[model samples]
Every structure is written in structure tokens, then in C-alpha cells.
Target: MVADEKKIFGHPRGLPWLFFIEMWERLAFYTMLNVLLLYAKDFERGGLALPSGQANEIYGFYLAFVYFTPFVGGILADRMLGYRRSVLIGGLVMAGGLIAMSVPGTTFFYSGLVLLVLGNGLFKPNISVMVGNLYAAGDPKRDSGFNIFYMGINIGAFLASFLSSGIRNTYGWLMVFRVAGFGLILGVIILLLGWKVLAHADRQPEKDPNDAGFGAVAGKILMPALVVGVITYVIANKFIPDFAVTPATMGFIIGMIPVIIYFIRLPRTVSDKERPGMFALLPIYVAGGTFFMVLHLNGSAMTQWAADDTARDIAAPAAFQQDALPTYYKNAGEDVPRPAEANLVVVEDPAVVRMFGQKRMDEQTLAQITARYPELELRDFDPKAQATDFSGEEAALFQFATAIYADGKVEVVEEKDAHGVPSYSAKIPEREPALRRVAFMRKTPGGEVFPTYLVTQDSFDEIYSGYEARFGHPPEQLEPGKWLPVINPELFQSLNALFVVAFTPLIVLLFGWISARKNVTTAQKVFYGLCLTTVSLLLMALAGLASDGGAMRVSGWWLVGFYAIITAGELLISPMGLSLVTKLAPKRLVGLAMGGWFLATAFGNKFSGFFGGIQHMMSPVAFFLVLAGLAAAVAVFIRLLLPKLDAAIEGLS
Candidate 1:
């Protein structure tokens, strides 16, 4: 139980306990996050099958609310619950959310997301505050401790990408959620076991006259924000329905009115001695928010690029290789093996084509229809078969067919015969799904028929047209079903965490060496981080150029390079921001200040979604250029404000 009895790699004994506790929790968190958008938009995998824009909006709102709740969590921990209890509570709730997501209904799925948001609010900021508490004021080890702590977060993230890939591929998506849920449960158990060791880091709730009470904050800031959000939703949908921003996003932005006003006025409530430090956090919040706006695109725009525009034909670990989908062949080399021609059936029926072309049915809807028609049989649509009495006329199908979706998961549409007894059509793959168009349909040896699509000639012309181009080889064809194994797009996210783990020690040593020789302020480090982010975006912009504005898939190395540059930038900003909040804020309000940092992150994450939602509006080159320009502007702004930021830090003990 004694915290000082032993050292953990030159830091407090409690550090390792907290580190692994966080590692497991983050494994669950990142596992879910990295797959969310893809799951929402996927049709072959029993996903929600939403449009890109709607999915991005949902992504933005979910992240925004997830971070936004930390504000309340921090307040509750400061005024009532201690850090340990909050962490435990948050961990358990998050586990439940993950489990709930394993259910097959949108209702359950959305409900699970809400639980995750609530649990994370309680868990995220408080655990970080505890890490800060382990170090004394002015401790030189504080930054390094946070860096180690940040490494724990990335370690989990790193594992999540691979674990998710393996699990989702082998066992399927729902199993991935179940496994993530269990991972969280294990994290909670670890925390319970280490409770005594973490005691020294837990702070008792204390009251200050200047501190805002929980009820007061809920009433003044939270309630008003909710009211504004509802009003904005209504107004946007009613009056500005065609506005570029979705109603939900519009509501989120306008709803920040109360929260923004409260923060702007927060300094006035604190004593004059503490006011400067509080004021200083405003710019830091802006910087943190801006930095994450670009960084978090890993789950949104960047992942989309990886999935669609980047070639994924490189060899992968044997264990990680998955059955390739029709989507994979879109931009693949002509040499990639395709299914045998005899195995494929071409559809000439426009009715069947339109049916396959519709948006896919989610599991929830499929379940409902199956319940309604207990005898409905699942069958694959074969246009060439005339033995069946059913006709391919569009209007005749309109009366009986409730819904039809791609893939075998929920591929039933109730059809009525002359007796009005309900039956179901066979499940068939979509003629055209997302980015690819069906060139042929394949029937597996097991008799499961599905459509396969390939890259358009335009894509081939752009990428392989020039035999002497950067790729350095002519396209070739291979025997059917002979395609090489390649990694999934989601797995690319692991690169960031891998780089973080690899680079953290180097970054720490380099910073340590520099600090020994000169006074390099934290603000200066953050400024440099922003500069690196700009460069990362520029790398992606060049990638866009290479891909000919997404006319063809480019090399996966572009994504690798992007992640490498951004990982370095992330190490500079993210952990430092966490450490900076703990150092600059008044002692009694550290939890609240930590919450504020997350709030800024929430804002930036929403903007990430915003950019992702609109990604198709501009060419990929222009899109990356805009983000790079934004990062450069933020870096310059931070440079100009460095003197004041340094003075504020110096003002601190």
C-alpha cells in the first residue's frame, strides 16, 4: 500500500499502476473509435450503411459530446467524488456501453454511445489529474511523467488497431465490441486492485468561496447550453434546412454559447493573484483545440483516404490477413487475382439492380422484418432464373418488398404470392456500393452469391497509364482468387501509436538534453509542435497530388509518412498540454482546468468532423492545403503570444 516503498523506472510506484490501468481503458476506447465511422458506413459488414456526410456528422457530434462531459465530470470530482471513485465509476459505465454496442439494434447502438460519453466524461479528466497530483509543484519530472503517461495512452491505441483488425476480421464486428467491453472490465479490475497505491494521488473535495457549486454550474452553464442546443436544432432544421452545416453541428456550435461565456467570465470570479494564470489558459485552450482539430482527423478524413485513395496491396502478417472485399479491388493492380468468370453472374434486370442499389438495411431493421414474417425465406436474387413465378417488374415488387440490403446479414424482403402468404427473396450483393461499381457477381463454392467491383478505367489510366511513372511497373493480371493479402484501412491507425512508442524516449531525451543547456519554455515546444502539424498536412497535400485528386489509389507509404510526422507533433503538444493544464491552473481547481482542456479538444474534434463531412466538396489537394494553412496560422498566432505565455508560466511557482 505504500507508494514510496519502491520506484517505478525512476518515478513514483503508483505510476505503473495508473499507466496500465489507463492502457487497458484506452485499448477499449481507441478500438471502438477507430472502427466507428467505418462501421456506420459499411454495408458488407452489417454496419449502419449511412452516407459519408451523415456518418461524419455523427462522428463529430459523438466526439464533441464525449469530451464536453469531462467538464461536468471534473467539477463533480472536485466538489464531491474523489479521483479514484470517479475513475472506477467511469470505467464500469464505459464497459456497459461497449457491451450494449454489441447488440444488433440502432437503438441499442446509440444508447451505448451515450453511456460511453457519460462514462468517459467521468473517467477522462480525473485520471489525468491524478497523474499530475503524483508530482509535486515545480517538479522537473512532471513533464516527463506525463510523457510516460501519454505513452500509455498511445500504447493502448497502438494495440487497439491490431487487436481490432484481428478480432473484427476473425470473429466479426459485434465480437470486437464484446472483446473491447471485456478489456474495459479488466481495466476496472486493475484499478480496484491498485486502489490503495493510488490513494496518495487522490484529492479530497474542498470548498472555496470563489468555486462554482455543482448545482450552480448545471443550472447556469449546462442547462442553458442544452436549451440553446434544442433551439438551434429546431431553428436550423426549420429555417436554414439547406445550410452547409448540418442541424446537429449548428446546434453544437450555437450551444457552446453558454459554455464559452462561462469560461470567458471565469477569471473574474477567481482572486486577483490567480487571475493571470486562469487568463493564460484561454490561449492554450484555443491552441489545444486547434491542434486536435487537425490531429483527430485520423478517424475521419484520414481514414477515408486510407480506405479509398491509398493502395493497400502490401503484404501483411499472416494472422492479420482478411478476406478481401470487392472494395479492395477498386484501385488494386490489374495483376491482383479476381474470382473466376464462371463463378460470376451478370445482372440485366434493372429492377434487381435498383433493389441492390438502395441503401443497406441495418441489423435492427432486418430483425423487425423477420419478426413480422416468421416464414420468410432468405434467398439470393438471380435474374436469369425464370423457373420462379415471380416477375422482375418494378411496380409489382413495390407493393410487397419492404426493404432490401446488400450482403447476407439482413438480406430479406417480404414478398406475397397469389394466396397473400409472405415469403422472402434471396439476399444478393449490391450492384454498386459506395466507391465501387459491380463488374461481376461471384458465387462462392458454398453457394453464397455476392457482387464484386473493380477500379474504373479512369483510375487505371491515372495510376498505371504511364508505365514509367513513380510506381515503376506495368499493371498485370493474375489467376482468379490469387490476390495478395493486404492490411485493412483501420489498421493503418496503429502506425501513429507505434511511432509514439518508438519516438517518445527519443523526444524525451532530446528535450531533456536541450533543457539542460537552455531555457526552452513549454510554450515554445507547443509552438514547434504546431509547426510540425503544418508540415504533416503538407505531406498529405503532396499525396493528394500524387493520387491525381483521388482518381487513383496512391501508395500506403503516404499514410505512413503522414502518421510519422503527426505522431512527433502529437508527442510535443498532447502530453505537454495535459501537463501544462495541471501546472498553470489554481490548485483547488485543477480538475476543472483539466476538464477545460478536454472541452477545447471536444471543439476541435467537432471541426475535424466538419472538415470530413465536406471532404468531397473540394479536391483532396485543396482539402489538405486548407488544413495545412489553418495549422500554419495557428502556429504563427502561438509564436506571437509566446512572450505572454512564458511570463505566465514564470509567474507560477
Candidate 2:
């Protein structure tokens, strides 16, 4: 049961290197992730310019596989490459993939994403084993070292958003992705240079008699799964036209059948003494799986909210800061021009909103307004900035956006410079101009409602300044409101990481005190962690309501609060789960078990994309609430069963 006996910082010296490597890896991953969707639909600005639903769905699928495949990586590394070799290979491959993603071609983009996925698989699980190797068995600092390492991961995540957004907005999308690749390369290089140092960590584990080689396993499961998945997708897409199937989703679902069966049958196949422990862990793992799905969605679903729905406008642009902080408030309307939205901003009456500060425009009416403002360049507008916008039509014939977002209003405060003194200014009559106009169709079917929005000349002048990433256009002259007051969508991606960094020390201290008091148990920490995740989700649900039904963007503080709260849960659960995997796994099957833990994580991660894909059907409040409720249920389950689970671990330990 003895692990490495070395000591550095009261723990293994090599731990820091692994810690930093993981930190950098997460940084690059989160950085590239922060702006991925925005780049996808960027169109002329080096984006694919797809529908939000499609973009989110694809995003979800990508994350799912990225996490899921690591099971295979852990296996390969344990059986053949060993942890260090696997980590090196994964890092190099990921670096190449990230670089390739910047190539700006459709093929290369997919290729890069695929490489990241495979590379992540190889590197993710084995690294955990390395961390364990740094500590002798039963060392108290083992968990603490992991917590420190976890901090490194979050540090990178916290910084990555700034790096990614700064690069993309300031430079270009290509540079942003290229920087992400550089991060991966740096991680690999650092680890390789310190190879001698980390060599004390996990080496190649012995293969079990039951361990089937890759070819035999891949042929038995992978080949058949691919063939079946393809046929199923084709048939679903064609004959059962109503039942469409995505290859990634179907392939993943079917591919898991063999793995699922393997896990289910393992307990029965193993000796009876291990049966109770294995059976007890199943629910814990399932619950953990569900929790991670919601938690991991931060990189996917929550990122969507930040990019599109959350308020991203920085209030004090250079122009407003010239005088005082309240200047933006004083000049609420006069100087703040509401710019018309281009065809590119994915909201209703984008043009009308430009004409009018906050008005409802039917699809058709908005199109007419846009056609009127033909001089404006819609192509340069950032799609992720606004929650909604003016559409191609006036918006009468069809309900273009979801009902939750159809009637949202973004606050516009204009700043007026009087006598060289700046004050808040806004356009307001005795009765505010109707920004949201629900007009009845004058035609025979007049009951059908047609909504109209405006594209005020003032609005147009203001919005165009925020977008600076396009090849020809940059928001160089920081206007009163940073152009459109569009949210810096990527900034929202960092909220969770920010919370992690902010709260990690506190949580670590809390746990340290608890363990010192002889009151802390892994099971208790895990149960509480689930509770925290539930609370975090509930906080997000509250944030949605505060948005006033998608009319206004909530404060970034809301994001900060949720992330901070949830991080406590993450600190408790993620590390504990890793420890449990190491402790409970039989030596002969530890790698596979490690893969199992990661596979559970992969399941949750993939489900995040699935949930993200169907974002339109549910309101943000409801969307987050469902997940919160699920977490609560799981927490309750864990609390009820903590005694038995603890005993099982105690016996094993």
C-alpha cells in the first residue's frame, strides 16, 4: 500500500510540476473554450456564423467526447505508455490540435477539436495517479497537495479568459487559438524538461489477465459501434425522418454499451467480498456523474449564457472615465447613441433597437428598418454581445426568438458632456418612445400580432464601437458605451475559475480545521459538496429572474456569486472523488477504475452539451433550476447513505 516516500513542501516535490502542468492545461483548455462559440458563428470575423442552437449542440458534443475518451487514454497509458509518456504524448497532440484549429478552414477546425479530445483523454486520468504517487499511502497531506494542485488548475482557468478574450478581441481569432496551442505546448515542454523529476511518479502498471489488448477490444466494441452508429444515424435521418440522430450522440451512446456492460458485470464476476463495496459505490458514482454534468456545463452551457444572454457591457469606457464614474449615469440618453444591429447580431429588431433605445420589432418591420439603415455594416457586429436583436423581418409573421427573450429591454444610458463636464444623458419624452411595439396586422387575419422595434440614428452610433475584432473594423475609439454596450462575452467564462481561486484557500482552511478537529470524512465532504452545487444552481436560477425576463442583462456579480459558491462544492467533491477512486480500486484494475471515474465525468460533460443544445425550449431560470433540483436530490441521497459508504471506505482503507 506504500506510495512514494519522498517529501517536498511536506509532500512529494514532483507534485508542483504536475500541479503547474495541469494548471496550464486547464488554462489553455478554458481559454480556447471561452471564445469557441463566438468564433463559430463569427462569419466575416472568422466565424462559422451558425444558429445558436446548432453551435451549442456541437459544443456539448465536443466536450462530451473530450472527457469520455480519456478512459481509453488512461488505459493505454497504464498498460503501455505509462503515465509520463502518456502525458507527454497527450500534451504534444493537444498542442498540435490547438494550433491546427487556428487554420481557419472547416476541415482543420474539426480536426483540431478532435485532436484536443483525444489528447485530453490520454493526459487527464493518468495525471491523477501521478499526484497520488507523490504521497505515501495514508499521508494526511495527500488530499491537501491535491487541493493545492487544484488551485493551480483554477489559476490557469481564471487567467485563461482574459488571455483568450484579450487575444481574440485585441488581435484576431487565429491568434487566440494559436495562444491556446502555445499553452499546451508550454505545458508539455515544462513536463518533459522536468521528466527526471516526475519520473518517481506512476510508471506502467501491470496488465491484468482479463485485460484485453486495444486491438481486440477496439475491434469487438469500437468497430461494431461505429458501423451500427452510422447505420442508425442514416436510417434515423432518412426513413424515420422525424427521428433524426446525430452521429456523435448516437456513436457515443452506442459505443458506451460495451463499457457499461463491462462495469455492470464486474461486481458479479469479481469475488464476493468486494461485491458490497462495489455495489455501494455505484449510486455514488451515478450521482457524481449527474453532478458533474451540471458542473462541467460551465465551459459549455454557462459560456453560452455569458456570450449571449448575460450583460457584458463595461459601463465605464474611456470616454465616461474622463470626468467621473457617475457621468455614465448622469448623461443617461443624450450622448449615448443606440446603434442599429447588423444582420449578424442574432436577435430580433437589431436594426430597430439601434433606431430606438429599447423597442420590440416584428421580423418584417425589423427587416424594413434594417433595409432603411443600409449604410450600417451589420457584418461587423458581435453576435454574442446582445441577448436579443432586430431580425430580418418586422417579426409579425413568425415568432423568431423564444418567448422569454422576445420582450426583453436593455437599459441605455447616454452621457452628455456639458461645459467640458460629463453627465448621464438619455432620450426621454413625457411618454417614453415605444421601443417595443406590438401592432395588429391591418390585413384580414388582423388578430395575428406584429411587433415592431426602432433603429434610432442615436442607437446606431453607440453600438458600433464595441466590436473591435473584425479584420477591417476595430473599436479603437472607445465611445461613450464601448459601442453597442455588448457584453465581453468571454469574460463570463472566467467567473467559475475566479470563484475557484477566490474561495479555494477558504475551503482548504475549512477542511483542514475540520480534519484537525477529527470531524471530517470523505463521505461528509462529498455530501456537502453536492449540496453546494445545488445551491450554486439555485443562485443562477435567481440570477435569471433578476434579468427581468431576458429584457436586461444581470450584473457580472451574479456570475461571480454562483461560481464562488459552486467552487466550494467542487473543492470538496472533485478531489475526494479522485482519492476514493485510488483507494477503492483493486491494484489489478486501478487504471480501468480510474478510467471509470473519468468516464463518469465524461458522461456528465457530454450531457452538458446536450442540455446546452436544447437551450431555447427552457428559460434560463427553469433550465438552471432543474439541475439544482437534481443535485439536491443527489445530496439528500448521499447524506442518507454516508454511514454505509464511509464504512465501506474505512474497511478498504
Candidate 3:
């Protein structure tokens, strides 16, 4: 009992171990997420290069299933394996999955995903239950303890982004997966170390006579659900193959109907006193799902924005610039060569050279380029000479000579003798022609002038055209003497976690100060969280508008600001939701209720993907405004239920 009664940081001795384990687990999870979208969309960099919609659909299904399996895992933990054993098994399985993901081939990729989903199901819910178990029935410290644990989750997430970026940039994408696997393995070791300390918290509750056993629950709930899901999938595929949403998402939404019914019927079987709380949970579940649908876009739509529409040239340390930047930009082929020392030596208007020298182009420049290169196509041209005789935007239509010979003068070998020697010399043009040229004065150690040319490819025209149409201008041009470091787009994904780490304490203190003045209920905090999330989306909508419907790139600060607001909302909603479930659910049904919470989360995550998949189909402003409206509506709906929810919370503490 003394060992069980041990306290650390004013909570159970096991709390820190659980916190560490969850932290590492999240590190592994988020590391994978940080690179997932990029990996799916990248083509030249040895990635799958799937369409945005397909990639988003896959992301959504994986997220949904990952959360959905916890329902079964929680039930198994409650009735069969105790919490510790379940946690151990889940950790190991998840670690293995992460490792497996590093292996090449589609089979391994899908297999690893399946394992991760299964493992998360077993691990996620039971750990939260154990945290709740650590406290006594009326312990006031429970909320704070969950908050501390939640911080650990963010710490892992925050670290994961940097780690994934560093590893992928330094080594490759495959190594990132290996690192995530190793992180999970470390977490399992820590979990094992605290095995005895965690023992008292592991419980397999005795089932009441009225309770449905595992087999009945499976047959009545899971079996029927699976059948419906399969039917929905088939129907969707046969009749609506081109539906706006993926067939998998449609199937999942349809399958959830029976499970939804089961939860709805649960309150009827409970006593009158417990019924209000159980019934109140349904609305809470809906709100939580709606919130997560918007929040989890970090991996899909938001990530796409980071990759395609955000200016990522953050002033990073020199070491990162040297070591990581090259790897991030690595493609499958050899590096394209550029002239080490070259001047524009413009024969045409100097203004054209100045416009081309810009890091990004403006609308006038783009229109000029389009008009000049009306028939521009990808073609091989001499590396030593310019592709066209003209200057400025006309030059962009052809490939420029990037290679330089030892001598500054152009040599023409007109004829060769038996020994392959030049017989005679021919007249050479005064100025070497190039297709496209950008002048840059390097700031790094070399500090040499290099003229770079755009590679001729179909994507070049497509990208430029899209940019011109969206911003009513060309991409921003670079200044000759000033250079912007190219950053790995994946790095931006870390901002959310970083914001969580930075703002958690301040938000906590703010809430605590408010609660001290007026007893802030969990429901109220959740409502506040919804409002904040709406604000975050609104900020993004404004950013979209500012970007001229995502034709131009926005500043990275927009993402930072959005994440900061939403993280504050996350702190208020996510952990509080967990705590609320523990406080309100019937004692015998805590694990199931926890599963229900995750089930809602699973749906929300799935919808997050669904929305992300459709991002390209709509203008950026429309996309963000739709999400903002949904979150705002959910907030208002929750506000209407506040009185009933407050009544349900009466006497729980």
C-alpha cells in the first residue's frame, strides 16, 4: 500500500512514468505525421506522388481507424488484460509498426499502418484510464494531473517535428521512420521500468449481471457495424466512385450509425441519477468530434498549405542551413549544375535582368513571361549557351547553358583531324544565350555570383500558370545580394507542437485565475475551447484572403498564430474532455465511455482528412471559411446545452 501510495509532483508515483511513456509515444506518432503528406506528394524525391485527394483520403482513413480501434482495446483491457499489460503490448506493437514502415514497398507501408492502428487502440485508451485511476474518487488534483500529462504529449510532439525534419534532411525519409520506431521502443522500456509502480492502477473490474459480456457486445455492436461498413463500401464504389468524398470515408460514416445507436441506448439501461450524465455525453461527443475534425488538419490540408503556399525562409542557424537544407532538397537525380561566376551582361533592357534577378516574380513580370513564351515547352538546349537570342521573360522559354568551360571565350571546333583535333575555328556569337536565368550573389562563404536556370518540365508551366492566375502576379523575385535559405517544408508542422509547449502554462494559469474567481466547469472550458478554435480558423480564412485565394505565398507567421490560438483551445478542450469523461461516466462503464470519447475523435480526424482532400477543389478563402463556420456552429450548439450539461455535472466532484 505504501508503494501504491507514493506521490510524485503531488500525484501518484506512477504519473511521471505514464507521462514519459505518453510523451515518447506521441513523439513517434507526430514524427510520422510530420512527413506523411510530403512523402505522399513528393515525386522527384522518391515519394509516392499521389494526388492530393487520394493522399488525403488515405490520411483520413488511417487517422479514423487509429482512433476507432480503441473501443475494442478499451473493452479488452477492462474485461481481459489489465492496464499495464495492455500498455506494454500496445507499445511493443506500435514500435514494431514504426520500424516496419521504414522498409520499402507498398505492402510494408500498409502493414505498418495496420499495426499502428491496432497498437494505438490498445495503448491510448487504457493509459488515460490508468491516469484517472491514479486519483481517488473526489481528488481535486485530477484535472491538473491530466494537464501535466497533456503537456508531456506536446513535449513529444514538439520534439518530433524537429527530429523528423533533421533526420529526413540529414539522412532521408526512411531514417525518419526508423527514428520514430526507436522512440517508441524507448517508451516501452520506461513503461517496463515502472511496471511495479503502475501495478496498483491496473484493474479488471468485475462485471455486473446486467452487463453485456465481450462476445455479446462484439456480436451486437462490432459485427453488425463491420457488415454495414462493407456494404456501404461496395455500394459507394459501385455507384459513386467519383463521389466528392472517398469511398472509405463514406463507408466509415455509414458504419458508425449502429455504434451511435448503441451509445444512445446506453443511458436507458442506467439508473435515473446516472442517466442525465450519460445522455449529456452524446452532445459532448458531437462537439468534440466537430472540434477535432478541424484541429487534425495539421497533417493534411494545413500541411499542403505549408508545402505549397507558405514562405518558409525562416532565418535558421547556419549549421542547419548547411547540413539539412541540401538533404531536404535532394532529388533522385544528380544535382543540376550552375555557373560559379557569371554576370547577366544584358544586351537587352537592363530592367528585364533586374526583374528576372528577383527571388520571386510579380504580376507584371509573369504576364511578360507568358506573353514572351506562349509556346514554351520542356526541351534540351545547350548548357554553354542561351536558349534564346532575346532577354528577360522571353529567355525563360528555353534552357540556358549552365555549364562553364575553363576558358572565358567560346570555342568552336569546326572540323577534327584523325587525332580529333580542331581543323578550323568558326565564328561564335558574342553573348551566350540561355532559356531562363536568375542572378544571385551568394551570402555564404563562397560569396560567388551564380546564374541559375529553371529546369524545363511540364510542372514548371503548370505551377507558374497557377501562380499567375491566383495572385494576379508572378512569384516574388529575389534580390541580387540578399539570399533566402530554402527550408524543409515539414519543419512548419512543428509549430503547433511548439506553440503547445510555449503556451500551455500561460493558458493553464489564465484558466486557473479565472476558475479561482468563478468556478469554471469543464463544460464551460470546452465551450471556450470551441470558440478559440473558431477564431483560429477565422485567422486562416483571413490569411487565405490576403494571399488572394492562395495564389501567392503567405508568411509562416500566419501558421504560427493559427497554431497558437488553436493550441490554447486544445488545452482547454482535449484534456478537459478526458477528465470530464472520468468524472461523469458510470463507474462500471468508464473504459467504454473513454472509448466513446475516442470514437468521436476518430470521426473528427476522419472528417479532417475528408476536408483536406477537397482543399484543392475550392479557393483557399472558401475552404477556410467553411471550416470556420462549422466550428462556430458547434460552439453555438454547445452554448445552448450549457444549462443541461451543468445540471448533469452536479455533485460529480
Candidate 4:
């Protein structure tokens, strides 16, 4: 039946099912990731409100472990479950984790993350292995098949950002999880429906007497990893509290030692022909890891740049306005205000009045809030003083306060004394804060009135400083209730996915055209990919330079350009790496080798986080330059080894 089946896009009958399944899985994954950092740092919008460094640490560790688990999962699938069962189990587990994320509370959140990591381990590598299994040895369609499959992954990623933004904006962060969970469930259903069609690709390796069994691999790899990880953690804690490397990072690096040793010893166990291939894989692994360290910054440093440093005041398109566009905001706290809108209503709060008058503010809370607004002064409640006597800053401390309602309305409240004197009190809104628009009656070059959104006072100050320098005057303020819309930070993240979807087909065609005329080895493609990645960072470095080290926001096109450049590199390197693994790995260890690719990706992701953790300490240009230099170095190294790698890959495909 398999032999009689018609091909879809020059691939097997089962390819579409696997493609859609992967697409849906990535949709769920990217949807969750789109809002992760924002949710962690949000203060007024019911997020964890963690510091950037701490949040990035968690992000990095989560990504690292998620990729790491595939190593074990691949071994298990090879020996016991077979690819199909492992994939099914993984899909279901991931769906459950996504659903669990919708439940409120820190425990559920962390627990959900753990489940996702575990499930992805089982699902990710094995599924890719199945894709390769569908093709016979030396099939010309192999690389193209992976590319088609890769497109599916990007398609899901492309849609997720916009869809997640809409759901999060309309409902809340929790609802985003629910929607993503449903997407995964749909993917699982599709896989089940096509189970028989995909069955041919599911292989349970024939046991070889010389092959390392599951128990042996676990004891030598897993057990040693755990022991080393624990020892590293304790040592890092007791002896190196002030060390440059974090304990989590140190532990992860130490834990990988045994696995590294295992790979090093693997070539010795294989045949002489396989030995060169394995040796060639080592450099490829290093290059892959280094490349991903920059690529995965999309979730950490790049996301931060989108949130804190990009100009987002341009009007959203009508289509996006109806969905994801509406939910976008400048920061995590409040919604961008609408132009000429009166979403903020003044209301009186007696609690604020009494708290201000009685000097009942918690010292810690006062310190924290005041730290954000250093000029704010809290005056002791003077019953005899009239509200009119206080300055705007003093009045803001007690008499005037802002609160956001559940339905996204910002209210300003004023307190009245017994003598009918009005005092100002600021209230922190819970849930969604209504958009605050700042009316800037300035006209554009086209003579249309310019629109502006209310920025955080901090953001506003920075912007105003730059604006004043450029235009010779501060922007005119609008009367109360008037505002301009600000763009949501998460919306910027969609650009990379968008570029991937838009360009993948073109890139594929171009590469095919080139491949037909001239032999372009996978190693050569990866080398070019590294060069493009370096250029992407260099573009960012230029943006930073133009912005004077992030003293002001840069244009959104900077991000667009960066994503476009890097995504081209991604298309070249990432999918090619997967294809290379399937081509190079011995048939018996295909799944395990695929796991090795993901493991390298895991390390790169960890490095991305480590780089992000220190982002606050360095200027933007310096940070970007450092990454560019690393990528450039790797590109050079790959160039030096291209000859040997090309020779090793000869006749393999």
C-alpha cells in the first residue's frame, strides 16, 4: 500500500500528516513562548513580576532542559517504545502540560514547564527520525522533504505570535495557554487519524549484541550526569557564590561532560567508514551549537529589545486591529491608549486617602515604588492642609492615583477631606489597564495629524529627551483623556516567524537552483549560515550605535531587517542540520544522532540565556558586537574544516 501511494509535494503519503502535526506542535510551543518574558516581568497585569535577570535565567534553563531530554527519549524509542508510540506519548504529554499552564499559580506553571520539557524530549527527535525513515537511502528528495517539513514548523510559529497576542489581549495570559493547548490536541488527533499511514516509518531497532542496551546507556550517561550536576551545584553554592558563572549554568555544563565523553567514544565503537562521519559530526555540532546560541536570542535578548527599545507608535493594520493588534501594548502593565479617547475616569478612594494621611505605607513597598519614581515624595497626612496647597508631585502621592479596571479602564481617584478639600491618591489597577493616549497634535509630512500613545513616564522621559534634541522642543501634551496608541512589544517577535514563512520557499528554490548548477555541500550551506548570522548581529550593532547605546528607541525596521537576515541563515543551517544528521548517522542510531543535534541546540539556547542575563551590564552595541565576533569566529572555524567535512559527506546522500 505504501509503495502504491501517490506522493504529496514529491514526498510520501504520510508526509503531510507529519508536517501538519509538527506545525501544530510548534504553534503551541511558540504561542507559549511569545508572552513568557512579558508575563514574568509584568507588575500590574498579574504576571510574576520578576526581575529581567532572574526571568532570563529561568527562560534559558527551561530551553536547555527541553532539548536535553531528547537524548534519553531517543534511546528509549530505539530500544522499547518505537517511534510511533513515543511520538504519541509525547504529543499527549505536551498537550496536558499546555493545559496545565492555564491553571493559575506558580506551582502549576513550573510543573507545566517540566511536563513540556519531558514531552518534547520524546516527541521532537523521534518525529524527525520518522521523516528520514520515509525516504530510502540516497533518495534525492530527502533534503527537500525536510525543508517542506521545516516550512510547516515555521508556518505554525508564524501564526502563533499573532494568535497568542489576540487571545492574551482579549481574555488574559491564562487563556493564551488554553488556546495553545487546544492546538496541540488537534495535532494529536491528526497523528492518530494517520497512524497507519505513518506506521511504516516507525522502527524498533533490531537488538545487536554489541549495541549498548538501555540500562548500560542510562548508567553510564544519565546516572553520571545527575551525580556531576549535583556535585557542581553544591560546589558552586558553597565555594563560588560570586563566580561569573551561575550555579545552574555551571551545573548544566558539568552535567554535559559525561554525555560529551560518550559522543567522543562513539566513533571508536563504529566502523571505519562511520568513524570519519562521526568525527566530522563533532565540528558540525560545535558550529551548530554556536549558531543556535545567537539564533535562540529571539526568546531572550531580542524579545527584550522589542519590549524596551523599539518604536511602536505606528498604526496597526486593519486586519491585526481586529485580532492580535488590539492586545498589543508598549509594556506588560497597561494597554496603549486610543487617540481622542477618554478611557481614564477620575474616582475617589477613601483607603488611599487614609493610607496617605496615616503614613501607613509599608517601608519596603514604599522603597520599591519610590525606586521607580525617584522624584515622588510622600508627605505625612496633614489634616489641616488644603489639597490645593500641594504640588503636582505631592498631590500624585495621595490625592491623585490611577487604577485600571477589569474591563481595561484607567480611573484617576481623588480623596476629599472632612473640610471638602480634595487630595490625590494613586491606585494600581488589577488585570487589564485601559489604554492611555497622549494627544500630540503634530502633523505628519502627509499633513495628517500624528497619533501618539501614553508611554510610561520613564519611557516618555527618554523619548522626550531625544525628541527635544531632534526637534528643538518637547512634544505638546494633549488634554486629559486624549492619547495615542502604542504598539505591543510581543508583536515585534512575530517578524522572525513572518520572514521565515515569507522567504523559505524562495530560499529553497534558490538553493535548489544553485545545487543543480554547482555542488553546494551541507557544510558549505552551514558555513554561509554562520556568516549570515554574524551579519544579523552586526546589523543590530549598527542599530545600537545609531540609538546611542539605547538612549532612545530605534525604528522597528531594525528588528525587521535583523530577523530577515538571520532567518535566511536559519533556513540554510537549521533544516540542513537535521538533514545532515539523518544522512550521516548510522541507521541503527538515527534517533540518537537526531537527539545529538537537539542537544547542541540546547547548549546554544543556554548560552543565549547566559548572554541575556548580563545584558543589563553592557551597552547594546558592545553586547551585539560580542555575539557577532563569536559567530564570526565560528564561521571561520567551519570554513577551515569544510574540505574534510565535504569529503566525509561525499556519497553519503
On lDDT, the leading prediction is 1
Q: Rank the candidates by lDDT, best first.
A: 1, 4, 3, 2
In the range 567-606, model 3's lDDT, one tens digit per residue, is 8898889998999888888777888888999999999999
The TM-score, computed over Cα atoms with residue i paired to residue i, of candidate 2 is: 0.75
lDDT tens digits, residue span 520-633, model 1? 888888999999999999999999999887767788899899999988998889998998899888878999999999999999999998998888788999999999999999
**lDDT agreement with native, every candidate:** 0.77, 0.64, 0.72, 0.73
For every candidate in turn, the CA RMSD to the true structure comes to: 9.3, 13.7, 13.4, 10.6
In the range 1-653, model 4's lDDT, one tens digit per residue, is 02314677667887898999999999999999888877765533445545566678788898888888998888888888899899999999998998888876567788889999999999999999888888888888888888888989988998998887766644567788888999999999999999988987887555567779989999989899999998998999898955667787899999999998888788788888787887888888888898889988988899888767776766874223321111232221222232222222111333322232222223333344446444333334443333345453443232222221233122324533222344333333333322221112233346543222223333333334544555566545434333344556777778877887888789889988998999888899999999999999999999888767776667889999999999999888988898888888888887888888888988998988888777767899999999999999999999999999998899464
Which ten residues in a row are the worst by lDDT in model 4? Answer: 323-332
After superposition, the stretches of candidate 2 with alpha carbons farther than 4 Å from their true spots are 239-251, 271-277, 315-337, 340-482, 485-487
Ten residues in sequence with the least summed lDDT for candidate 3: 332-341
By summed lDDT, which 10 consecutive residues of candidate 2 come out lowest? 319-328
Q: In model 1, state the lDDT of residue 204.
A: 87
TM-score of each: 0.83, 0.75, 0.78, 0.80
lDDT of 2 by residue, 1-653 (tens): 34555667677779889988998898889888877766664322325544455566567777777767776886787678888988898888899999998874567888999999999888888888788777765677777877788888889998997787656544456778889998988898889888988888866567766656677657865577667767766665566643333455665677677776666666675556666566665666766687788877776677766654564455633211111111121112223333223212222433333223222223454455446544322222222222123332421112212111122232223322112222221222322223333321211133422222222333334344422222236333322212344435567667777777777778878877877878788878889889889998999899888865554556678877777788778888888887777666665555666778777777787777777766545788888888888889889988888888888888876
The superposed Cα distance between candidate 2 and the true structure at residue 236, in angstroms, equals 2.7
Using TM-score as the measure, which candidate wins? 1
Segments in model 1 whose C-alpha atoms lie over 4 Å from true places: 1-6, 333-338, 348-484
Q: What ranking of all candidate models by TM-score puts the best one first?
A: 1, 4, 3, 2
